[model samples]
Target: MTFKVGDEVTLSTRAGSRAVVEYGPYGPNGDIYLVKLLEGDEQGEVFGALARVMSTPVFRQGDRVAGFGGTEYSIVAGPFTAHDTWYVVKDDKGQHHPHGDDRLTLVSRAPKPVGPTYELDGVTYDLGARYRDKDGDVWRFEVINGEPRGGMNGKDIYGYSETLAEVQQDYGPLIKL
Candidate 1:
């Protein structure tokens, strides 16, 4: 049971997202364990999964996940009501999503498609607005190509549905996906 300062590990038994062990009661017999997540999907929406310990953890505290190249974001006061409680993330640039790049331009589409489909664990899923945390850090999301995807931020997890009417009432204005 040898863990390092920034060792990437999981719950080892439960359905937990991947995270880096921040501090491990590290020494001989510490009781509590501290860690920060490494990889995840469906921000704001919580999914169920079990802990499968990682053989190796990739990123760390000093490592950046927002594609900002090593710029660590600080999670300040959030839960902003504009859309939800948005965090006060202080950084050079706001969060960056995996799609907002030269290759995958998230430009609005005319007569936008119903929504983008994201398949997870062999099941197809549709989501609305993909959101970020306080620091402009885009989340692990697949945005709609033409329209905004609709869904709830972490504070608004009740905003999801396979029904178009339900999605429209809850997250229609957010995104096409």
Candidate 2:
């Protein structure tokens, strides 16, 4: 199969080695290709390999994935090559890190939003509604002046169930007014 530049592929001759298609297939049948190795001792080295010797990568950049057998998700930092299986991940403390792709599972590219309606204390609250938290702090459950309130930061409130109980179960409790 023909491969393009930036495509992460494996080489038949180097079994498990990852490389990126750098240059052309100048041979008569367009089978020859120049690939740069992405892993091992020869990382950054280039070589000429036949089309039959190159296979496409299993994962691509921007793919949402989970690693370490955890529920937290991360984005693929780049092409999944032997050397850079790094993922753009954030820890519990909200710190970013490059995580390895061991036992990684692909997740949906984006989560489904739970909509702007929330039910609490037999009352329904929509976006921009004011609510009191357990700490007695009042906040609007909407984006105010381009800023998020009531812990409605994109990551904190979006993609959760529409029920207040469900949201509280995941993101701490918020008392009803």
Candidate 3:
């Protein structure tokens, strides 16, 4: 039984304890498995188990799930297997968290973001609006080729948002110009 990362399997040592394979095939013949226990007193702890102790993950990418708390919903970002397998999940607040599958329950999928443009307060300021920062440097928001762009003193500012509040937040105090 070859166990890959993110595979859900039962631990022989822990009896009915379920775990997800974090890494494996480490020993001489490639049978030792590093897994995170999913239940009992040792829940959430990682341990090295043999190949005969694990199974496979039942969930797939894009699956909606909620943590054991079951309050907030999230989407599975898929398993990341670098040093260990981490089931990555993106929550409602757009934050990602790693968890064992045993700690998650299937839930209704959430809606995806429509696009980059979003309403902040109610007023959508026009592009090309100029503002002077605290340092007295003037910046302007411009849309070139239908894409939002920001420039300060003839230099392009990358990752600049087309919002007034964002401009103020990034460049410090700003006076409309």
Candidate closest to the true structure, highest lDDT: 3
Q: Per-residue error at 37 for model 2, in Å?
A: 0.4
> Cα lDDT for residue 83, model 3?
38
Candidate 3 residue lDDT tens string, 1-177: 687888778554564456888887798989898888754445578878877545454455667777877755455554433333448787788887888666778776445332244223564544535556776556666554555555664355555444445655677565555
Q: Count the backbone clashes (under 3 Å) in each candidate.
A: 27, 0, 2
lDDT of each: 0.36, 0.58, 0.62
Error of 2 at 59 (Å): 7.6
Ranked by lDDT, the better of candidates 1 and 2 is 2
lDDT for each residue of candidate 1 in 41-138, tens digit (9 for 90 to 100): 43232232222233232221222223234444433232122322123433456653221121221122224224466543454545422433343222
True-structure RMSD for candidate 2: 18.1
Worst 10-residue stretch by lDDT in candidate 3?
112-121
**10 residues in a row with least lDDT, candidate 1:** 99-108
Winner on lDDT between 2 and 3 is 3
lDDT of 2: 0.58
**Candidate 2 total steric clashes:** 0
Q: Mind sharing the TM-score for model 1?
A: 0.25
User: What are the per-model C-alpha RMSD values against the true structure?
Assistant: 16.2, 18.1, 17.7
